[model samples]
Target: MIEMIEIAPKVLGLRINGKINEEDMEKMLSVCKAKMKDEERIAVYVEVEEIGGISFNALIEDLKFALPNLKRFSKKAVVSDIKWHEPLIKVGDKLFPSIEVRHYNQDQRAEALKWVQE
Candidate 1:
């Protein structure tokens, strides 16, 4: 399941658990774009309660959504308990030095949100 955990003007927060399908990815992209319209730079906080693989169509949608917004977001904070998730996100930082995406341990979720707001 996916939920909008919080939102503040130009900032958006999301929580996702279990497997993510193409519909979830599409919905998330729609919500994010709709909420962030007219904003030049966006901040996002994503809390992953659990990690599961995405569907083939979801993977395609994810790439489509992310590639366009790679430099549009000022900060992207990913909160998760899984240590392995860090490596996956760090690759984005390497690819896009303009926008840095950080991984926060679940306990540091508040800190992650604060950094995103900054």
Candidate 2:
């Protein structure tokens, strides 16, 4: 499941658990775009504690839609226990100069939030 909430004028909080499908990716893209339309400097806090995995097609679509927006965002924080996600996130950080993706333990959510807010 994907849950998204606007925490601040320029910040969005996201929680994802379970497999992500194309529909979910599309929804997330729409939400992000809508929020970014109002705020140029978007920040995202994503928690993926229960996310089992993401489909290959969904991942591709997500990247296609999100990459451009990442450049417009100020920061992005990804909180995940999954180890394999680190490399992908690193690549994303490299691709998006405006965004910084930091992997944090679930317990370090506060620190992660602070880093992104900085």
Provide the TM-score for each candidate, comma-separated. 0.90, 0.79
lDDT of 2 by residue, 1-118 (tens): 6777566757778889999888878788888778788986788889896876788888999878766555687788898888888899999888766776788988888898887776
Worst lDDT run of 10 residues, candidate 1, spans: 1-10
Candidate 2 stretches with Cα past 4 Å from truth are: none
lDDT of 1 by residue, 1-118 (tens): 5677665766778888988898888788887897668687788889999867788889898888888877777888999998888888989788888887899998998798888888
- Clash tally, candidates in order: 0, 0
Window of ten residues with lowest summed lDDT in model 2: 65-74
Scored by lDDT, model 1 comes in at: 0.83
TM-score of model 1 (CA atoms): 0.90
In candidate 1, stretches whose alpha carbon ends up further than 4 angstroms from where it belongs are none
